[model samples]
Target chain A: MEKQQTDKRAAIMQAAMELIAEQGFHGTPTSQIAQRAGIGVGTIYRYFKDKDALIEVIHENVHGTFISTFTESYDPQLPVRENYLRIFSTLTRLFIANPYEIKFIEQFYNSPYGIAKKRADEIECDKPLFAFFGQGIQQQVVKDLPFEILLGLSLGPVLFLVRDHQNGFVNLNDQLIADIVSASWDAVKR
Target chain B: MEKQQTDKRAAIMQAAMELIAEQGFHGTPTSQIAQRAGIGVGTIYRYFKDKDALIEVIHENVHGTFISTFTESYDPQLPVRENYLRIFSTLTRLFIANPYEIKFIEQFYNSPYGIAKKRADEIECDKPLFAFFGQGIQQQVVKDLPFEILLGLSLGPVLFLVRDHQNGFVNLNDQLIADIVSASWDAVKR
Candidate 1:
């Protein structure tokens, strides 16, 4: 019974994400999420007390999934450059596979919904990404600088590539991705 | 008479930017802009045919100011690292002086305004920024890679810094800015 309930919750969350991505958070109706999930509207209410509750769950799930995927693949034993490469490739694949998640995240961060959750998440998961860079600095593999600055240096190119891809301003390919990864590694690796 | 007209236009643009920064584009009204500029609504009409016309002028002015300021200070004859430092410092100063322009530009790019002007601007001014990087590669002062990739590597940290500053997530200090620029140069210089 517990497993069945969890499945239902996941289904509802997945449906909500798709709807939000298609129509934006403001445009998506709770009824659409319920219908898409093949569940009744009342079932949604059982899982989420209200529309805002559902949206918050969706936001948390998306961020949690991103954090888990990124950290699960992270191997502290690996060389710093290799570790960074793993992160770059993993993120590109994740963003490409879940373009809706990418769009939803970008939209959320630029909206009020994100503001409420950002501080908590930053305290929990986001700081660790910077901490990983600090580890690299300690190991003398990355430049010795403020970890945030190091992060901006390492991740800035990827953001531009992702933004360009999202806007349809440029077409990304394996070779292009490889070139970007190489250039980024060249820039940050001591 | 022409100089007076240009000054009024400038004042109007500055007022519109401040209002948009505070209230968002959708939330702001033309009357508010006129009132802010201390000009009659009719004067705004004389300078701009409509609200959209005014935004376009603002966009053009901001882009023109950024490009001219950067280019005027850029010495193509300098080595790549020095050139990067100069351009980065100039851009940082510009962004610091006109923080509202950064927010306005982000909002503008995410809206229809970006699509309308991006193509034209791509051909005219955007190409030149990339060409400047291409020149660096030719001189062997920059790493050999796709120019866009190199450009991203070079400019990404500065963008993130501006973002953090705008969001009140970080304070902008000369030391932090210098460290970021230096770290970025280390990343890309051959």
Candidate 2:
């Protein structure tokens, strides 16, 4: 019974994400999510107290997925450049697979919703990626710039590439991604 | 008479920008801009047919200021590193002096007003900067990557620095700016 309930809850969350991505948080109604998931509205209520609760769950799930993907593939024992390449490549793949999640996270970060969480929880959630970057600094493989600045240096180009792709300003070919990754590494690696 | 008209137009544009920055486009009214400029509302309408026209004027003025600052100080004859450093320093100073303009531009870029402009006008407005960068690539002084990718690599760190400063996440000291510039240049320059 517990397993069945969990599966139903997962289905509801998945449906909610799709609806939210389609129509935004304010535009999506609980009834629509329930209908889309083939579950009763009461079942969604049992899993999430309200729309806000559902959104939080979705946010946490996306963040968790990003963290786990990095941690699972990251090898602390590897050379710094190779480790960075792994993290970057993994993140690019994850983002490609979950464009909606990327949009959701970016929108949330730019909105007032991002500030209510405890800084500790936020940091803890991001610790894996941060630790990988921190390792680079310790090994003197990256510049001694602040971790966030280094991160922006390494990640911002790809973000722009993604943005350009979305805007139809540029095409996203493997050659472009390779150039971005190489240029990014060349910029920061000591 | 022409000089006096130019002065009045400049005052009106300045007033409109101030109002727009403070209250956003939807929140600001023409009467408030007139009052701020110590001109009658009729005078504003004489120069600008409507609020949208006023916004266009502001956009053009701001773009002009930015382009002039960038090109006037940019020496294409210099080595790539020196030329980049000069332009970066000039831009940093401009951003520091007019942070609100920077914010306004960013907000405007993400708004419908900016979207209504044609791609040709947008490219024409930014052509000087693009030409400088293209020259760097042609001279083999910078990375031989896609122009947009190279641009993102070069400028992405500065955007992060500005964001950190605006959010009070970090201080914008000379040392910090220098380090960021050096690090970013290291990433892209050949």
Candidate 3:
């Protein structure tokens, strides 16, 4: 794509992300998304074949952004605890800062589109988190448990806590975050 | 209600559960549920004010079943660890035993219905679990963390693992369950 078209596509994606985050996939209309993007409906077609294709790209983009954010913060040379803490803290802060991304992920994970995407895609997303946990287990720094079990013990709570905070069921504070991190660390510490 | 009426209601709920589990809320119509129950379409209206009411009933049924199952096996006099172990194990086994119930819950939790239901409902939903955690925290048997956080740390893993197992992303063996319970205990232990 040319420079102008690339910018236009970016604009469309941002618009789609905003609308879908607010109204969900089924509730969103392509024309409304185009209007929000400041582009003609036909221009959307030029960038993507259909709404499903557009959604597919958006899902990939969101997942990719999460991976990049996590992978960037991770330092293998650092002590295992610091490295894992970096992964958790960076991802949690980014998620809180970008409610749109969080909303997009929550909605996608709940919908049939998200369910089908998981089944269709063989490649495991969040490979970086797994690698960190894998290293921790191998080094005997973390609990000698399966990677999946470790994730469920740690990130599982983080996921629920973020959701809880988002839904006004619980208040989030630095102290609470500290407590959670402490508990989560204990959960996997050897 | 008469015995026959009670039987009919149970039949309607079972039918609704099956269809909703298979096709989700939007895809399954009341008429289809009625047909599957071998009852008249008018009978559904007679029982439920609307589809939403029926769904609300289903949610209550599933939750009620979970609570009863947990409570039946619970002995308040047992050690805190034993009490919690029963909870984690009972809930996981129930979820695994009833794939339909799990599907119903996953779909419901991912919808506006689930979010709204959480807000509207009081603290009574998980009373047994809460009582156990409250006592543990009180006695300093568990960490002085919030009951909600402990739940998120413990049950959260069980929920994710069950969902993952259902999706065939991970296998749920006894050893994995034991490992998760151990980690969860570690997460909440003083």
Candidate 4:
């Protein structure tokens, strides 16, 4: 019974994530999510207090997964550059594998919900990644820029390339990913 | 009479843009747009065929304005590096000046509408910019990567920084803009 309950919750999240990613949040309805999940609307309510709560949980789950993947084998003793590469490449692979999650993240960050959450300080910064950047800057291994700017410089092109890849404009094979990641390093390195 | 008609049309477009930028497309109703414009709901239909048509027209207008601004004083006779700096700085300035339009664009490109347009090749690539990239590659001044990859490397960081600036995470003054643009160039240049 516990297993069944967990499966149903997973089903609800999967359905909601797919719908919200494909359509803007406002475009998707809770009823539609329930329909897509092959469960009753009330079942969704049992799992989540409301649509907002459901979306928030989805965000936490997805973001947590991303953070875990990149930080799994991360070693603080490694060269900052090596640590940076590991984080970037691992995160990129995760994004490539999970296209829908990527789409949902893009939508969430650009939506009013995201804006409000950010303003309220609810969406905490990824501390591990930020700490890595700080250490690199202090070591004079990276540019002397704000953390936000560094984050943008590091991940901006990557996100753009991922979009292009998802759109069928480019195929990000292993070689290309390596090359691009190297170039991204150049963008931030002093 | 014609001048009044133009003003009304402009008013409707302005209202729609603002609402859509704040709320996702499905979240915004045409009636709300009309109310915000201080005009009748019917007035919007008179100017635009429907919401989709209105959105398309807005995309074209915003994109056209961006192209015109960057390409206005563009001199192909200049070095590839110079032209790139000019284009990047100009576009960055425009994005800074028009927060609503930038939000609209970010939302649009990540939405189904933007995806569909891209798939259908309806969203034409900017020719002049492409030509510049091509020229740089041929001259061995830039990395010999795919144009799409080059584009991501060039504009990805800029867009990300713009978002950070909009969210008050960073203040993108002229100096930082110049530095980021230079870093972007570094990512693409040989």
Which ranges in model 2 have alpha carbons more than 4 Å from their true place? Answer: A1-55, A115-122, B1-61, B112-122
> Which candidate comes out best when scored by lDDT?
4
Candidate 1: residue A177 lDDT (0-100): 75
The 10-residue segment of model 3 chain A with minimum total lDDT is A119-128
Instruction: State the lDDT at B92 in candidate 4.
Output: 90
Best-fitting candidate, scored by TM-score: 4
Residue A125 CA displacement from its true place in model 1, Å: 3.1
True contacts kept of each: 0.47, 0.44, 0.59, 0.79
State the lDDT of candidate 3 residue by residue for A160-180, as single tens digits: 878777877777677777788
Query: B1-190 in candidate 2: lDDT tens per residue?
Result: 9998888888988887876665556546788888988899899988888888888878877877887887788886888788888777677768767866776565455444464463554577457768877888888888877676766776766776676577555677888777777777877788
Clashing pairs in 2: A187-B187
Clashing pairs in 1: A187-B187
lDDT of 4 at B24: 64
The CA-based lDDT of model 4 is what? 0.84
Model 4 segments more than 4 A misplaced = A119-123, B119-123
Candidate 4, residue A186: how far the Cα is off, in Å: 1.0
By TM-score: ranked, best first: 4, 3, 1, 2
Which tens-of-lDDT digit does each residue in A1-190 have in candidate 2? 9999999988988888877654555556789999999988888888889878888988888888877886788888888898877777667667766877876665445434554553444467557767877888898888878876777777777776675565556776767776777778887888
* Candidate 4 C-alpha lDDT tens digits along A8-108: 99999999999999886877888999999999989998989999899899988887787677778578999988887877877777899999998887778
Q: Enumerate the chain B TM-scores of all models.
A: 0.86, 0.83, 0.83, 0.92
lDDT of 3 at B135: 91
